[model samples]
Target: MVAGVLEVDPAEVTDESGPETIPTWTSLRHLQLVVTLEEVYGLSFAFEEIRDVRSVGALRDVLRAKGTVPA
Candidate 1:
């Protein structure tokens, strides 16, 4: 799902699932990403939440904390 948001091949996602190597995650992509994530997870993130999310793992953590992601 993160790969889809980044517009990259899912295979390129790392085993550790970090965001540092996600080339599409520049500042310009942030808003689009947040919107996409909101749709995917069915939850709206506050501006501060979006500001604090820096990585795919972090985003997943946020969704998990919100109980939005299906286990």
Candidate 2:
């Protein structure tokens, strides 16, 4: 999903991948990713949670906290 939003190869994305590491991860793309995740996971994120997610690992952690993904 991150790769799809950023238009990058899935293999190019890692736990540490973020706007700083991915040239295509513009602010707009980040918003799109958030929307996509919400739609796909059927869960909403708090403003602080959304703001705190800076990387794939962080996003995964949020999902884990929400019980949306396996730990």
Candidate 3:
């Protein structure tokens, strides 16, 4: 999903992948990713969570905390 939003190959998306590593992960794409995750998971994120996610690992942590993804 991250790769799709970033318009990158899936293999390029590592846990550390984010704006720093993936040039396509612009602010607009970040919002798109947040909305997509909310819709797909049937859950919403806090403003802080949305603002704090800077990496794939961080996003995964948020999802796991919300019980949307396995720990």
Candidate 4:
């Protein structure tokens, strides 16, 4: 899902994947990713929480905290 939003192959994404590491992860793409994640996980992210998510691992942590993903 993160790779899809970044318009990259899933094989290219990892727990460290993020805008800082992915050139294609522009601001627009970031928003798209946020929206996609929210919809898929059925959870909304607060602005501060979104800002805190810096990588796939961080995103998973947030989802886990929300009970959207099992720990």
Q: Best by lDDT, which number? A: 3
Q: Which 10-residue window in model 1 sums to the lowest lDDT?
A: 14-23
- List the pairs of residues colliding in candidate 3: none
Clashing pairs in 1: none
TM-score of model 3 vs. true structure:
0.94
**Which residue ranges in model 1 land beyond 4 Å of their true spot?**
15-19
Q: How high a TM-score does candidate 4 get?
A: 0.89
C-alpha lDDT score of every prediction, in listed order = 0.75, 0.89, 0.91, 0.84
lDDT for predicted candidate 4 compared with the true structure? 0.84
Instruction: State which candidate, 3 or 4, has the greater lDDT.
Output: 3
Q: List the residue pairs that clash in candidate 2.
A: none
RMSD (Å) of each candidate, 1 decimal: 2.3, 1.5, 1.4, 1.7
Over the full model, what C-alpha lDDT does candidate 3 score relative to the true structure?
A: 0.91
Q: Write the per-residue lDDT of candidate 4 for residues 1-71, one digit (tens) a residue.
A: 88878989988888888888889988788888888989987889999987777888888888888887633
Instruction: Name the runs in model 4 displaced over 4 angstroms.
Output: none
- Order of the predicted models by TM-score, top scorer first: 3, 2, 4, 1
Which candidate number would show the highest TM-score if scored against the true structure?
A: 3
Q: Against the hidden reference, what TM-scores do the models get?
A: 0.76, 0.92, 0.94, 0.89
Candidate 4: count of backbone clashes, pairs at least 3 residues apart or interchain:
0
Model 2 Cα lDDT, one tens digit per residue, 1-71? 88989999999999999989999988889889988999989999999887878998999988888889823
lDDT of 1 by residue, 1-71 (tens): 66776788888866345456776777767778788878877889998988888877677788888987633
Which digits, one per residue and each the tens of the lDDT, describe model 3 over residues 1-71?
88888899999999999899999999999999999989998889999999989999999999888887733
Model 3 CA lDDT for position 71: 31
